[model samples]
Target: TKMLRHGEVHGKPLTSKQKGLFGLLAGGGKPTRLKKKRDRRLESR
Candidate 1:
């Protein structure tokens, strides 16, 4: 909706939210090492 408005009328590409979400996905979204780090910490304790 907003992207359509931007390109059709406002002339921008996309919103910041869309860009951020894309970036997050491209970068693998969540912290991939979370469980590994937790296990390592538990082992050290």
Candidate 2:
């Protein structure tokens, strides 16, 4: 419940690994492999 109730409450983004760990502890399911998507908008010149 901490994940859902307090994870994002700080206005910070949580990494995939953190999400997976939280999910597991919360009895939601297995840890999911998160894919890294390239953000074109953030690409450096």
Using lDDT as the measure, the top candidate is 2
Worst 10 residues of 1 by lDDT: 1-10
Residue pairs in steric clash, candidate 2? Answer: none
Off by over 4 Å in 1: 1-12, 30-45
**14-34, model 1: which lDDT tens digit per residue?**
667666555566667764466
lDDT tens per residue, model 2, 1-45: 775656674789677767767777688564334212334335644
Among the numbered candidates, top TM-score falls to 2
Q: List ranges where model 2 is wrong by over 4 Å.
A: 2-7, 28-45
Give the CA lDDT, 0 to 100, for residue 23 in model 1: 58
